[model samples]
Target: METLSNLECFARAAATGSFSSAAKQLGLTPSAVSRNVAMLERNLAVRLFHRTTRKLTLTEAGERLADSIRSNLEGLQDAIAEASDQQQEPSGVLKVSMASVFGMDYVLPLLPGFLTAYPKIRIDWQLDNRHVDLVAEGYDAAIGRGSELTPGTISRTLARVRIVAVASPAYMKARRPPASPQDLAGLDLIDMRSTRTGRLVQWMLRDEHGNEAVSPVGERIIFDDPGGLCKAAALGLGAAFVATSHALPYLQRGELIQLLPDWSADGGPISIYYANRRYLPPKTRVFVDYVADAFRDQDLAGRF
Candidate 1:
């Protein structure tokens, strides 16, 4: 039991790269967690971590051991919790990741109700654009568009994100509105650079009639974030190709108008993603279900 505790501490520390973070999750002091890791290293006759004043990184041996024990450790913990009566209610720190705009616009609105219902389930939400390594990073789940189907992870799509061309109402009034996708080349277009690829996001426009045309990419105005792209368009900087969800609020406010409404592209699904494990933590399970239910009930998929 003592060895198992030490291993738990080591595993948490390895995942977070910080003794304090591991201790917070484990409900132990940082010193205690550090001591447990040190004890683990001694018992195994291997230095697990390369510790410095500024950072803590796993040694090669530590990385190998962490990978081997991750699933096993989770299974053991789940089994123990299942056999115990204390874990009936979902109560734990639920670490989640998502893009800032999506989380704030969609997921954050659902939080008040979710937190009120599951008062014991604390949230550790990370608003980031990068695709996180779910198991390795110890994240309970992530919400975003086009989440990669990484090994040991499963994604449940919430919406079929439709991409549309949009421009400020003033800009549209000044310029002859694009009569067709081909006319987009003549407009002062705002572009979104993909954060992952560091390249301009190419707009492949498709209509219900099965016709396809590439919307010309522009170098005049560029932004890495959808929010920035939409804002620039709203300011009449140029027309922008953006996800409907990203431009929905501006469109509703009449600040922006949809262009070539009949033509749009599949922007991929907005999904809730988690590790594919045999036994999921109750907190994670409930949060996933709650978000899915909210999307369905509100018809966000159809709206987007």
Candidate 2:
């Protein structure tokens, strides 16, 4: 057994309290993780964990050792990160999780510039609509749009997102544009099922005087995916309310028209969050900085 690998496996298992979970985090098989821990126990002549079919409990010795080594391991990782950051060139794989629309429309396009600046770094990007657990899933960082961030993660605001109401030109020609939030009651709205709070997303609007009001509109079509909803709106199925960033391209291409132009909703901050800020790997830290700089203008409406 590689002593260092065994030590890392043991520490991760002790911290998470499950061999399988630790194995998953470390990208190792459960059997390999178990063997490593067993080898460490044999070398120390003490059982580390009390095992059962349902769970695992650390022994007294194991608990004490874990506590002692955890800080040391963290310090070592910090030292490595610092050293790597100071190197002349950064080289590594950066694993990132981000929302599908934003990732495709913005982040992916900026990759060429980022790659040119740091040629040695490679990105492993995952785009999904759902929130991801960065640390538990071994992702270096995640970009999310919301004011609420997960606990114990370091986050930095990258941009301000704006939500807007939109519909295709044909749809608007058929139905008059909503003059006020109350006018939505008579219009057909496309609903995103994922945004349902208590069966429907409250159709929120801002009046000319800047006061906000909610009007639940009738749904002609419902979809879970933003792409699908955007497509349906482009086909003149119904009026769709979405982020300006997501709808801008269609609006610019004349595929969709912005509705209630005078009204707008301030979405929470768009931020890049990381699990371990203090000891982030060099690649992740660099990528985070690059992304923040790229979106610093916060002019998504102009880009599309």
Candidate 3:
């Protein structure tokens, strides 16, 4: 049991890359977390972390061992936790990840009510655009546009995100509004530059007539964040392609106008994602169900 506890401490530290963070999660002090990791290394006869003043990183052996043990250690912990608590109510810290813009626009609003409903569940939410390894990173769930996820990722569809072309009324007044998908070429288009690929995001649109238009690659204005591009368009910088979910407020307030309303590319479903666990933690289970219920209540599930 002591060895298992030490291994748990070591895995948490490796996942978070900080003794303080791991200690907080483990309900222990930083020194205790550090000592536990040291004890783990001593028992295994292998150095785990290459510790420095500025950062803590796993050594090669540490990386290999962490990879092997993170999921297994979590499973063991979950089984023990399930047996001890019997899961009468959702409790403990729940870690979740989502895209910043989406979470702010949609998920953030649901938090207050959820907290009121499940006071025992403490949420630790992370807004990040990059792909996350849920089990490896100790995240309970992730919400965002559902694409291909890692193996063992189970997803629930929350809503369908539709991509639309938008521009400020003042900006549209300067040029004839895009009568068709191809007319977008005439506008000063603000588009996103993909951080992962370092290239412009491709815009493919289709009209009700089934006529398709592909956005030009070398757009004049390129922004790294999608939200930034939308703001630029709202400021009359130019027309930008954005998720309708995020642009709804600006459109509703008459700050921006939707162009080619009948034409929108399917942006895919906004999904709630979690690992497929043999023993689902009560906190994680309730959070997923709560969000799904909220989406259904709002009629937002699979609807733009």
Candidate 4:
């Protein structure tokens, strides 16, 4: 275990090019990183890093050692993680990221049941719409649109959501209800912009026969959040396209009315993503499976 820790310290230092950066990633201090590297060097009887006032550089031996141990070290860590997960009840902080609206509207409801099932597990949930680094930021899982997933992670589809055009009764009274996708071009538009790209989300409407229809958009008001877009539509600001999961409550409460029922856009897969499939923690494993089962039971799959 000591050897593995030392090797991990060395690998992190090498990858980040500094003890301070490595320390930050490892939740340790720079002195700890330096000490670990030194301890490893002493055990191996080799100088690993060339130290100077300005910068730290790896020696030839250090580079070779890094190249050799990086993969094996990661594999060993994964093995240890898998082994740890195999022991008893899942009991650790399961850090997760999720889109705000979906988390509150759907995932949040499952929490009470999940906690009842696995009392030992603790959840630290972060609500954000942007893509985050799962490894660097130290999140166990994230629930969001599949398109937001970064590389080096695996995702399971919870459901494919149908993006439907909706508006409040007042908004429709102000302007005629859109008869077809073509009429949408003349209506007041409440658009959702991607925070990552600052671009208006494109629409892909399909009719009952599964045919694509072009709806040229005019953005009278724009928001960077799905909830905000829905709220704007509810406030009778304009017609907005939102996921079924997000609009379900509003639709049920009669705060918003669906338009062009046969015409809808594919919201893509909403998935539960994790950094590693090879070593999923028991808490995360159970939560993902439970969520899938819940969705299936409620028949929310593909609709939500």
lDDT of 4 at 4: 71
Off by over 4 Å in 2: 1-7, 14-21, 24-29, 41-69, 195-200, 215-220, 297-304
lDDT of 3 by residue, 58-115 (tens): 9999999989987787788778877965837888898999988878877898999989
> How high is each candidate's TM-score?
0.86, 0.83, 0.81, 0.85
Q: Order the candidates by lDDT, highest first.
A: 1, 4, 3, 2
Q: What tens digits encode model 4's per-residue C-alpha lDDT throughout 154-253? A: 7888888888999998888767778898888788888888877888887889998988985566767988999998898999988888888888888989
Backbone clashes in each candidate structure, one number apiece?
0, 0, 1, 0
Candidate 1 clashes between residue pairs 3 or more apart in a chain or in different chains: none
- Evaluate residue 216 in candidate 4 and report its C-alpha lDDT on the 0 to 100 scale: 62
- Per residue, candidate 1 scores C-alpha lDDT tens digits across 173-279 of 87887889989989998998887889899877899899999888879999888899899999999899999998999999999999998999989889999978766
Number of the top-ranking candidate, with TM-score as the measure? 1
How much is the lDDT of residue 104 in candidate 1? 88
Which one wins on lDDT?
1
**Model 4 CA deviation exceeding 4 Å by range:** 12-27, 38-67
lDDT of 2 by residue, 166-258 (tens): 889988896777887667667788887653243655546776697887745566688766777788999988887787878878988999988
Q: How far out, in Å, is residue 176 in model 2?
A: 2.4
